[model samples]
Target chain A: MTSELAAGVSGARMIELGRGECLALLAGVPLGRVGFTRQALPVIRPVNHLVDGDTVVIRTHPGSALARHTTVDEVVVYEADDLDARTRTGWSVMVTGRASLVTAPWEAARYRALLIPWTDRDVDEIVSIQADLVTGYRLLR
Target chain B: MTSELAAGVSGARMIELGRGECLALLAGVPLGRVGFTRQALPVIRPVNHLVDGDTVVIRTHPGSALARHTTVDEVVVYEADDLDARTRTGWSVMVTGRASLVTAPWEAARYRALLIPWTDRDVDEIVSIQADLVTGYRLLR
Candidate 1:
């Protein structure tokens, strides 16, 4: 099937990861990069995230650009990986979804308490990305 | 100056990185994520790269999507970071540039020898992104 491609490298092979495995690996990692279009160009930022089922959530300060700009329905890309540079063997997951600030008081408050942002800034905004598409790959030896 | 911003996080502060420091940091890292638009949506991929002056170079197989789509003058974003997950302290660099396949026989030959793909697949295409804009930040404790 054209579903994936495998290529060998120094006894290691690249494999396409399934959705279930991708979500599990994402939950295990605390940080990832978020990509969005701004000024008609792509922008990426490193942020810590939490996986709620298939949705990804992140906390940010109100003063942050990500918080100010992502008000409602912003299509974005979330990526995280645990690859070792020296070994070049690991897995990376990419999630494409629409990001919106969590406006519901209950959900926002719960995330604020559950997810400690990588930055120590006082975070007042929680952005939830509903995954529309998920793709991942792993390098195995 | 609007050139930079600083925010405190615990005992650390987030500071904007200068261009010189950004380039130096990128030169030290071998891998990064490249972002480009596909079908009006943003896509991110983790690929190993080399910093040549203000340009970033990557090798991809001709069969790969990146090589097929990025024929010439495509705007793309390249991001790389070195941060600790536990401490969340590190520097991240984001570069905006026009990516084009290296067509010159001499240049392609040189890069083909210098930059090795992380995957062991046969790679025949060399893409060079000329950095038109460079931005970076560091979380320091």
Candidate 2:
């Protein structure tokens, strides 16, 4: 069964997403993947996140794989994409920045209020990735 | 609007996926994210891929970000997940391995016949990420 979502055309062009538009799209999505390294091997984890100003905030367990792999000042990537499963047309926004754990009380509280993990676990650590560089693209066809 | 897909329960236990199961799941999915590093920053790109034995073969443009970031023996992460949008219950599989440009004539031809890029672009590079270590998890609720 097809829904009202936009369908992919036979011959569509690629559209470059502006920085502002990329941020807007990223801020709107709830699920995103975090890219990082563990023991020098690249790793990706799907985490529920929220865009807080210029920072991408995600709730993770203090001992989660993400937390263990990410450290202060470590460069990480946060990407979110919205694609029509049927049409396979979508837009992807990627943010490259440094990741740091939220240690301050007020800031941690703020993140805690805004972001919630989709999985059940003790989520007290708030990892924030600075959205220093944003790049995006739209696939239409 | 509820579908018959698994709905996440409120207090479901986390299930660990074995290596064989993880590889099987990865082989079944047509799309996955490739994680790599560019200038020391972690990056993730979504691509259509197929599992050819222990190798994950994908097609991408020669000048694509993924192609530029990946080199011979470069460590990369390939991940795939199928989570319900409404229920948010799904399984995720991640493979950590080195990305290599397929140079063998026979392997390239084999990959070309089996894999196709989802985007409209000149896909001249056939990349194979060696599935060295596979890890997966299932969220049930």
Candidate 3:
């Protein structure tokens, strides 16, 4: 469990990724899934994201259950990966942190300008998650 | 909240998916993300899965945290999506259900042969999540 390397049955080895590399990979991806608790059960929503400094930011509408139910300092998980199914090789990064609504007008405005929502909806709420714990793995042959 | 039409800013309309359609889409995907609680916080993992009947099954090694920590009847969320970044059109399906380890020798063997593990690791544990509540959305431009 403590080892960083785990070889799979398909002749691929899993290498643990560093924080710096994880953040870099996250910034390059256009989409990610954010997981939060709803009714004490997990709920995942795939949304476009932008890496702002050390935080992961996403725009959601007021009508979205994700934005409406997320309380301040709520723990959430954001994951993004770039993998090839054919080769079974790629990297996946998961960031677990506290989620809070970006209520500041200027901050929200900046995020809105940089992070465009993939769905056709108004950007009514901007949620920023502090990347407190980052873990990732890369499968290599 | 109940009507099921939410359009994104990119002129894409979000249409809710039905149970039958969600299952069909899930069967077609080779990969998905499973979200479960770890230490009272959400954890998301990308794993290759197979839709067996109405359940999503994935194999894991014993050392993996997901398999080790997941308890019987643990509420989990499994999600799979196929989206085009350029066109901003795609479909996402989510299934929330209880996760149980496949302890039956025969059942485990069947899943082992059918569901290929993405990583190069031994298949020591098999997890099956019942598709209790299936929900999805299709983004159409």
Candidate 4:
């Protein structure tokens, strides 16, 4: 628990999560929001993801707009947040990194086994982001 | 319903919703993701918002990181998506606009009445993004 003195010293009491906490939130969470660009306009979608080391993995249909827009070495932002409305307490974590399609058959197979899509649509395209920065924040009631 | 022949045409199979349908999804939705920046570093977060005309309304506590980063007249991106895992059918909408604080006393009061925060934290600052562009896509199972 954070003390009143510490809160006073900081002026505001927002909780800050470090690298380990941020990693835990990213790894344990199933749903996240991905932000990318199509024709220089921003697009965001919610997706289920899997975290492996410093990389985040997601799958999409081969002919989808996301597949068309995202390219190797393109910058993308991925975020996940958990909030408890009752307590008004929550945490949000974001990962910004370079995105690339995982084309290697063995790597794709490994991700395919671990990252299961609830949709029946065949997700032939797999994208992964090599995170350059990971940060998170928590709010305490 | 879209016909199979229509689906065969490139870009003809895309599902498009008008202003009302898009606004309904934006207002009724509980969770959304916002893509913004601080010094060109992309930051994305899950937020709860309301629809105000052609703009998206969001409230954040004063002195918060998000509040600090977002200023009036700054361009930002807001996105909302609703997905059904079972049917593999969903819609996503993106809004690129300029951000401005809602500061008029009467206007703020009206917004305060219409917009309620999902979190109990104090939200003294309210910002609205007047969308310059709005686009959405629907997935057909």
Q: For model 4, what is the alpha-carbon lDDT of residue B9?
A: 23
Candidate 4 chain B least-lDDT 10 residues: B1-10
> For residues A42-86, what per-residue lDDT tens digits would candidate 1 score against the true structure?
888888889998799997777666675677587889999988877
| 2 against 3, candidate with superior TM-score | 3
User: Comparing candidate 2 with candidate 4, which one achieves the higher DockQ?
Assistant: 2
Which scores better on TM-score, 1 or 2?
1
**RMSD of model 1 against the true structure:** 5.7
| Top candidate (lDDT) | 3
Rank candidates by TM-score, best first: 3, 1, 2, 4
Each prediction's TM-score against the native?
0.88, 0.86, 0.91, 0.74
What DockQ class does candidate 4 belong to? incorrect
lDDT tens digits, residues A1-141, model 3? 111123233546899999999999999999999999877889988988989889999878886667765665788999999888888899999999988889888887777777766666665688998899999999998
Please list all clashing residue pairs in model 2, or write none if there are none. Answer: A9-A141, B8-B141, B9-B141
Give the per-residue lDDT digits (tens) of candidate 2, residues A55-129: 999877888667765665788899899866456688889999988888898898767765645566677788988
Summarize candidate 4's per-residue lDDT along B1-141 as a digit string, tens digits: 122223332121348776667777777776677777655556687666888788898877787656765664766788887665445467878778777778787886666655555444577578787778787767664
True contacts recovered per prediction: 0.41, 0.44, 0.66, 0.21
Greater-lDDT candidate between 1 and 3:
3
Candidate 4: tens digits of C-alpha lDDT, residues A1-141: 122233232122357788778878888878788887666455677788988888889988886767765654777888987765345468888888888888899998778766666444566688998778888888774
Instruction: Give me the TM-scores of chain B across the candidates.
Output: 0.87, 0.86, 0.88, 0.79
Error of 1 at A104 (Å): 0.9
- Native-referenced DockQ of model 4: 0.20
Better of 1 and 2 by DockQ: 1
